[model samples]
Target: MADYVIKTNQLSKIYSKNKVVNSVNMHVERGKIYGLLGKNGAGKTTTMCMLLNLTYPSSGEIFLFGKNPKKHSDEIYSKIGSIIETPGFYENLTAYENLKIISKIRGDFDPYTINSVLKMVNLDQHGSKQFKDFSLGMKQRLGIAAAIMHSPELLILDEPINGLDPFGIKEIRDLLKRLSREFGITILISSHILSEIENIADVIGFMDDGVLIEEISKEDLHDRLNKFVEFEVSDIDLALNIFKVLELKENEDFTVSGSTIYLYTHLSLRDKFNALFVNAGIDVGKVNLCEENLEEFFTRFVSNN
Candidate 1:
């Protein structure tokens, strides 16, 4: 019975003959970071656009803070901030100057707010630096500062770390974590960087070919990433029978593949499995711990889907 900050039901967008965004139901819980993961042309951006009311949905509904976005456009959007793709800024203006313009448009202009937000994003010292003179990371940081300057409760970032170096990426990642945990801000971030998303996101939603294929929590995803002990035996059928006798339920505690059985239980049970097989007169050829990381899991899921 947790409250969702953003929810979409059968949200879709079509462009002529192409269904850019198929029916997608997304859920973002309050004060948690939700990662939207997909490869290029997976409709991640389109989905964000619909939520932000930037692009109208072809069919379906969107709710922000429990109210329909179209019905309460200004009131609902005022509580949200977003950066889709590359953020545009007046190249000739200084960082502070650019944010001043945004603050004015937002009608929440405050000098203290500008300074605090710039400092928060590590752009305080660069306030006087022109947008054209800033580095890629600096520009991105400024974009984030502008997004959060009004202190919105929700943030939607599409590949915010797209061009950042390792250090910059880590900085942004830490900032995002702090925003969610400390400030209680809900975030929906889209990225092709599976590792970063895996490290930071509480929940992950995967999109494939414009379809939302799966949505799972980080802990559940780790469990689903195929971590187990694989046992190769001389007699496959006999091993399965032995497993059954041991009360190791198939497709639950173990799975079969040709001449091998993979135990889904922890590796701590390795000794027990070996002893059981050996006592049953089954020649256990090999036993090895196997696991798949997020990147490998994502690739496999996409290919299979």
Candidate 2:
């Protein structure tokens, strides 16, 4: 099989002349969690829908397991499990009964597998509880149980932790990590919870206004938002003159805000910079190292794009 578990090329979805997903190319590598992040109406769900073949793309192609989805949809989808939006279950039925129905529909009914998945998601103890009486977290866990009971090679979850408490969220996070690490399942998860995604995802795809603006690995993204030195000088005008004299490229090398200058490079030459200012008859107040976290970086990226 190809290296990518999921791949899309120039995928587009349009309705009544409005482009919901526009020329989006995405890649989800084997055995890695790819976080699809965006605000509402940013086309995250639509993109997932197209990938799952729930919604036909207006143009372009989708590949699952290295084959075109249109040509191998049945074989491909059978190997993938997904929970998009709220999953439906018989409210009056117990958790076990609900999964039993799903097992029949899946046509690979295995009682032992069902029980194993329920235990995996921490729903085994609550299997006798009626779905109607289950808490939101319990219901979500059941949904996960149903999705994984068949042991699919790939999983696509849209906001799986929506109604979860902090503890529930951590439980699900650890479960996903375990699934990926132990079973070698590739996951494509979409969430507005950037921090959770930052913590769990191996790669991140940022979307905005129906466009895939950037797809970057978590490590590379962190490096791009690395720490920089911020200098608070006494004279703004004289600082600019000094920078010009030193052939420093404005904005490229540093940014100015009132009396503060943010330096993006030459971090190791901090003493040299200070000496230059001292020799140039400029007064430097404070110099501090600063860094932007993922959320701040995402905001800046969205605003810029």
Candidate 3:
């Protein structure tokens, strides 16, 4: 089992009469990507703010590296790096200079760290050009370079792929995955990009209206999201009779599409089911599992919520 680098218990934040984040209990395991997903105005950014100590929660507790930030020394916070909203940069300064300024604040400026992080985020080419001259995607990459300049153990990024094109998005995604896999940095990434999360997240936490509705591993989600095994049989009446003898739970939950009968189970009961049909003078055409994509699966949760 992986150690939890960060954990929250019943965390919440309210503004006047409305709750922006309500009872959001989530965890980020060490060296793993935990994708915090939600719709717009669904409290993902607010929850991330509470985690980073940029915004105070109305009630509840949060632990970073197994200690409360409120009670711990400032040294404890130095291990974290975050890019909550748009990362501010000196438009007059080049990417390297911007990172140099950040490194100076921590009193650990080095050419090696700057070069290493720039290469990690694929921003090594932006040397002398000022920040204003960089494209939106280039700026985002430079922002990430700044975040990791100090070699922090935890990195929290919200909407990290907001402005990037497909190639840029892929580059950022691969960099994040490598960060977790190679450097052992824990990541808490908040984004509505389900496909992006699906590609990298080891664990996924779904937030709805400020509340965490579900938390599941990518492997477990695959089992659940593999909706049903469909079979097309030539005889409907014979198939229905065999289904009755199989004693499937909640018969109404199963559906038939033309000649195909969808059975919602991981185990393939086709051999047994087919034999029963064949003995009963029915022909079975095909049997296959029908799995929904990540977006469709997420929509099912949101609609049900």
Q: Candidate 1: misplaced stretches above 4 Å?
A: 228-290
Those runs of model 3 whose alpha carbons end farther than 4 Å from true positions after fitting are 229-288
Give the 10-residue window scoring lowest on summed lDDT in candidate 1: 121-130
**Backbone N/Cα/C clashes per model:** 0, 0, 0
Better of 1 and 3 by TM-score: 3
Q: Give the TM-score of candidate 1.
A: 0.81
Candidate 3 residue lDDT tens string, 86-180: 99999999888898898998899999989899888888876788999987778878878888888889999999998688988887888899999
- Candidate 1, residues 67-165: lDDT per residue as tens digits? 887789889988998999899999999989999999999788999999998888888887567899988888888888888998999999999999899
Q: Give me the runs in candidate 2 sitting further than 4 Å from their true place.
A: 229-266, 269-288
- Report how far residue 219 has shifted in candidate 2, in Å: 1.5
Angstrom error of the Cα, residue 285, model 3: value is 10
In candidate 1, how many Å is residue 196 off? 0.9
Clashing pairs in 2: none
> For each candidate, what TM-score against the reference?
0.81, 0.83, 0.83
Give lDDT: candidate 1, residue 120: 85
For every candidate structure, what is the RMSD over all alpha carbons to the true structure, in angstroms? 4.9, 3.7, 3.5
